[model samples]
Target: MSLIITDECINCDVCEPECPNGAIYQGDEIYEIDPNKCTECVGHFDEPQCQQVCPVDCIPLDPNNVETKEQLMEKFVKLTAKS
Candidate 1:
């Protein structure tokens, strides 16, 4: 359920608005997602909106931060509870 952005990002800022969980952010030079906040859009959408709107398809699964659906739900819970 993890997600990440690759270097293929063009910095076009197209994918930022598509995020439902507010996980995507402009990186120092590329875009990055806070793994703790990314829920793969499980709670808010059927698919990862960021990837769907990305002009370059730079957003992809984060191999290093892989998580299960249960974990993704947990992350969503935590993120919503933080406020």
Candidate 2:
């Protein structure tokens, strides 16, 4: 599943740099996660680095866009141009 940053986010900017997919973004005074680019770090890392670094724990699973490992790998390849 992709991850979503809720309104509880303080915009601390801690999770942005930790994301390998670059899915996290500043939302005015909040932070948002792009589901299209969010792979839950399935292809690039063993765990979701953003969630690990998020101080507020705002990052949560995006139930609306659940994806399989193969799908996530395909997305990772497209987003990263994995050779």
Candidate 3:
């Protein structure tokens, strides 16, 4: 699954830099995760890097944008190919 930044986000700015897919960005209120670019760090790391550094732990799996590991890996491949 991709990740979502909740209202609990303090905008610490840590999560934005941690996203390998560049999925995290400053939204009107808080940092938002772009599900289309999010691969949960599948091709880059074992775990979602943003979640690891979010001080408030606001980053969580997006139930609405859920995907299997294989699907995430596929996204990762597609994403990397563009870069």
Please report the candidate that would top TM-score against the real structure. Answer: 3
Which candidate do you rate higher for lDDT, 2 or 3? 3
Question: Please, what is the whole-model Cα lDDT of each candidate in the order they appear?
Answer: 0.85, 0.87, 0.92
Model 2 residue 22 distance off true place after TM-score fit, in angstroms:
1.3
Winning model by lDDT: 3
Off by over 4 Å in 2: none
TM-scores for every predicted model: 0.90, 0.88, 0.96
Ranking of all candidate structures by their TM-score, best first? 3, 1, 2
User: What's the residue-level lDDT of 64 in candidate 2?
Assistant: 88
**Pairs in steric clash, model 3:** none
Poorest 10 consecutive residues of model 2 by lDDT?
24-33
The superposed Cα distance between candidate 1 and the true structure at residue 39, in angstroms, equals 0.6
In the range 6-82, model 3's lDDT, one tens digit per residue, is 99999889989888889999999999999999999998999889989988889889999989999999998988895
Q: Which scores better on TM-score, 2 or 3?
A: 3
Tens-digit lDDT string for candidate 1 (1-83):
58989888889888777877788888899888989889999878888888888878888899999899989988878877855
Scored by lDDT, model 1 comes in at 0.85
RMSD of 2: 1.7
Q: At residue 42, give the lDDT of candidate 3.
A: 94
Local error of candidate 1 at 51, Å? Answer: 0.8
